[model samples]
Target: MKIDEIDIRQGTANTPQRSHGNCLPYVGVPFGMNYFSVQTNGAAGAWFFQPDSPRFEGIRLTHQPSPWIGDYNHLLLTAIQWDDATQKPDLAGNYRPTEATFNAHHLALFDDHFNVQTDLIPTAYGAALNYDFQQLELAHHGVAIQLPDEGRFEFTATGLKLAVSDYHGGEDQNLTMFFELSIPNFDAENSGYYDAQNHWHTATNGTGKPLTLLLATTAATVACQLATSYVSAEQATLNLQRLQTSTSATLKNESADAWNDYLGRISVRDHHPAVVQTFYTCLYRLFLFPQRCYELDANQQPVHYDTMAKTVKTGRLYTNNGFWDTSKTVYSLFSILAPELLPKFLRGFLTSYQETGFLPRWLAPDERGMMPGNLVDSVIAEAAQKGLATELMPALLAAMQDSDSKSAISERYGRQGSADYDKFGYIPADNYSESVNWTQDYSYSDYCIGQVAQTLDQPAVAEKYWQLSKRYLNLLDPATGFLRPKTSDGKFKPNFVPDRWGTDYTEGSAWQNSYSAFHDIDGLIAAMGGKDRFDAQLTALCNAKPTYHVGGYEMVIHEMSELAAVDYGQLAISNQPSFHLPYLFDYSGHPEKTQVTVKQLRKLFNASTTGFPGDEDNGSMAGWFIFACLGFYPVCPADAEYALGIPAFDQVTLHLADHDLTLTTANNHEHNNFVQSLCVDGEPFDAVTISHQQLMTSARLETRLGLVPNH
Candidate 1:
């Protein structure tokens, strides 16, 4: 049957003027089972249409409503019984798609009339089906299903082909299809999902429907045609090639391969599955951004960003925006492995700076300005020290200068090396205290910049910043050893309670922030008067049993305040400040403590859904998990060394660009959480600090396990 004309409307009462964006058309044999539907007006209502099908004899179409908050407001459907003789549709007792049957994006339904309807709607930007679906077919951008009366069908697209031998049987029916779509100038609103308002509109109003249908049909066909056509020669060849390319390209960068393999070895060699998963997952997250922008042209030279722009953009095109939290793990991971991309990554940051003057705090699609810290300096310094060329140094230096001269938030917090910075290394709580965490954040940023200078070999500058890093010491209450907020005149904030919310900090308390001294451990230890006192304070902080009123923000505060909880002891395991604190015991000359604490943290936290103790922080916390599981922790964010923790896996093999690295654990198990002995590349090792260069070269290490030490 020819599809002469089709129209879709958002409202039931009044039909709006026919716009090109509201119409869609499809043509094929009336296979009696094919269907189509769409939700407009931001998922307010779903309109369904189906042909006919004998297989769907007992099925009828039913609509499922979405609840508030979780309510997608998009199209949803079910299947019911069909009366062939009477051509009647029964809705009372209908079968529904299993909960896992449909992704949040689409709904499925079948009726006794042998008809089915599949919901199609966009959820990101602003929810609206703003494309002319019929135009999609004419442009050769969508699939064509050819169904014969004998219950056989063939589906084909730009570069895909498939055929269904017998689709009439239930569950036993075989189907196949090939699919491809050369989607040009295609872009989706925010990860192809809608935000709170249930909108799916795009910024530039690009032709989204074409790309959406093309990709959706491709994916859906894979599920339906899985049994038969999926293993066909054409399909097998495509799949194999894709896999080979992915694996080969990943191992192309020798340094990246080495670092990745080293991380894998630490986890597997230690016999730690949790560590392996978390570590590999963290590594995966790091690759999600600062994407490899240079696509190989016919000659294989770096080409422009592979978008519709058609412009020859150089360097790497990395994108995931986790700058705020990455400094802890993700940043270090990239600096060590993909140092070649550092210049490009820095260039991207400069682009952001050029667009918004100040460097971004947390860059999303736009600059979110979230969190504190002029962390750019730390990244630059860390990258340069690790043999990464800072070609963007001139640009970054200029941005830092501009930031220093400005009297904005940075100046208010005494972040820029201004006159008041020495006297008040941090903005007193009284001076424009917004996010209560600012004081602690100020100290952290100072330490980061100081390390950056040190990495650059500017000792005088490094000394100045290093002293600033110890500014947290000034706020330390000699009575409590907790780093409480202080006034510019060197007085503690009276009536300040360490556990109270908001008053002392954001998301955490003084008890948690007390451990924010990772950047200057020696100085902190000295200030507290030696390893014994330092160890005692740490023990008290970890052992102190405390309950907190987490209330509505339970997810945020509970993990931070409950010190007895393995996750809470080393400062909120959920927060950024405490990420490396568990490994600080190594610096205290008690490597065993570090091992014990690392194992406890991993055990208590890495369960199924609770795989994370706090905000994943765009994989920063995940990075910590990966590190601890692999038997080492960065300890110091800007440093090139990692303190040894207990390893987590039995064997891990990392495939790198140049060579391969392996790790194995002897007598490794959950009960054996302490390291009795260790060796790297067949050599004996006394303590656990691996150099940045060694980690990136791909090697093997083995660890012997033992029981935790008794006090």
Candidate 2:
């Protein structure tokens, strides 16, 4: 179905906008089970149906008047009971239905997960349990199930009885049984199912029992001797009421306030649901990290880490392990937009060090040192440059020391006096070729240390790593104009080709790794002789034939190749090295190329089913899309400014707590691919660069576009 054709209902108090389409309706938070179809417009009419039990697969609907059953193959009824005129069901008892009877609803035909694999059935039908049901219909509010046949059915009330008839029958005939339906506290004791120790369990009483149907039946028959005692309706109601009054209430209130603020900042001219979804999804992904660790006490202040008695610790927790890739973009964006969270994340890193004695490579629930680089250096330097105070300097220094001392390079560039300082900056391409290239990973780390040292006013230390930053130069073969592995005597390794994979670096060739000079583009350009030659080589690299094997256990290799094709000749776009490549076009007198490449990449890769071009590497690739679509990208994330790229939307309005920043594109379309002119708050600007501070605090950026290059 077309996304634009779907109707959206924001569900306000009185006036709610309702539309008819098969679009998914979401409430509460975006990450939860909020995507579900509440209604449909067309031939179906107002057929009221709620997904089976929130925990089941059946879509139960209360039919009015005559029972109009459609294709029975699509419906799966787990349990059914009809209330005879004589007695009433307790309206709050847990009844277990037989598997055979339950499977009759077509739900069983699919997998246990209830994901329908086939689309053979157009509709379904079932026997109507003719009983008086209540009707309370309102748009985007609670659903109404009406059964008018029986005397005043109290479906909405506390007590009701329904006699159930199984689809299967026998001679003895389990003819009729009472069915009860009531909403219980989702987290209460003995209230149906609950998650404990990462596994779900249903307690009939206060005690945990093996989740077996026969066991549950035996417990029900035996009474109090079984697991937890069954929770009463009054208790269940109180629990649910408490939950609704507390967590749900608070979330609803906060979400409402956020929504109001969001709406107030919306621009009528450029608003689109796709844009909103992408923006909000990006925002959602951003919050997935630096987890919510601060548990407020009764006074609403954050509690100490020690207070949770070792079960819960207070420090910093984050989600979405996209460090290697995200450090290039997303983290840089966060460092600008949300400086307050920087220290918390740093502290989290420190806590990780304290716990494991090493900074994590890629962290989720565990330490996955999947990627090559120690990107924390970039994050720390960016944070420091942006004026976010962190205890990262010492940690970075220690990490650098560890990396240096452990490297084969350090052993080669041995210092006569200090054993630790021996050959500290050199990595030999001899015995430790593989490890040496990996050791070159420290080049960026050293660059970061230089920034951190400069921030701390330690010029000597900064200068030391600044020289070390030229290690990429050490690997550079002036003979071939490619960054190749070097021997101990400072000679280029023999038989080095720019395109061959392996020996030169891991997963990438010299053509891809040659652009590792993002830390110093001028030095790299000079090393390449001049801007003209640099531009030519960059063009060659972008258009170069793909020689690397496309498929392997490592998906990053594939992505690196893709991204490399977009950057200054050498970017392995599908890999991490090429992340800053597109932005480098600005320095090479080709900012328009950056714009074109960014637009092409973003258009090809998005947040849909086929969104990512390669392995996400945590949220790194995702962050790239976020930054690119938002209009600018951090070329040297260690620095404080973002180089402009083509923006995906005509306008993007970021609604901050205190102010809003709107970016508007003019003369923008598929045909107009270059920036003809630009302005910030009507002030004419010649450059396409923006500072981190401007992005976080500016009022607006009005960009005038054109078909040709502005220069």
For candidate 1, give the lDDT.
0.45
Going through the candidates in the order shown, the clash numbers are 40, 46
Residues 1-711, candidate 2, lDDT per residue (tens digit)? 112221222111110111111111222221110111222121243223212222332223221110111110011122112122122211111211222111111111122221221111101101111111122121111111212111111222222222222211121122221223332211122222212222433333222211111011101011000000011223223322333333323433444443333234333234345644544433433332433322333343432222112333445443224355567776775664555667867766655555444555554332444445567667878887787865566665565445434433222121111222236444566644432344456676678878887878889988988887776666665556777666667666776666666554655676666776657888888887877777777777677765554222234333344544443344555556667777777877788888887767665453332344444443356567778777788878887888888766678776664787888888767777777777777788767678877767778888877888766
Using all chains and alpha carbons, the TM-scores for the candidates as numbered come to: 0.61, 0.61
Q: Can you tell me which runs of candidate 1 are displaced by over 4 Å?
A: 1-283, 290-320, 401-405, 409-423, 434-437, 454-459, 549-570, 605-610, 655-658, 708-711
Task: Quantify all predictions' global Cα lDDT against the true fold.
Answer: 0.45, 0.45
Write down the TM-score for model 1. 0.61
Candidate 1 per-residue lDDT, tens place, 218-287, comes to: 1211112111112233442343233233322232233233334434432233344554444553444334
Q: List candidate 2 stretches off by more than 4 Å.
A: 1-280, 290-314, 319-322, 390-426, 429-440, 487-491, 502-504, 550-572, 656-658, 694-697
lDDT of 1 at 475: 66
Q: For candidate 2, what is the TM-score?
A: 0.61
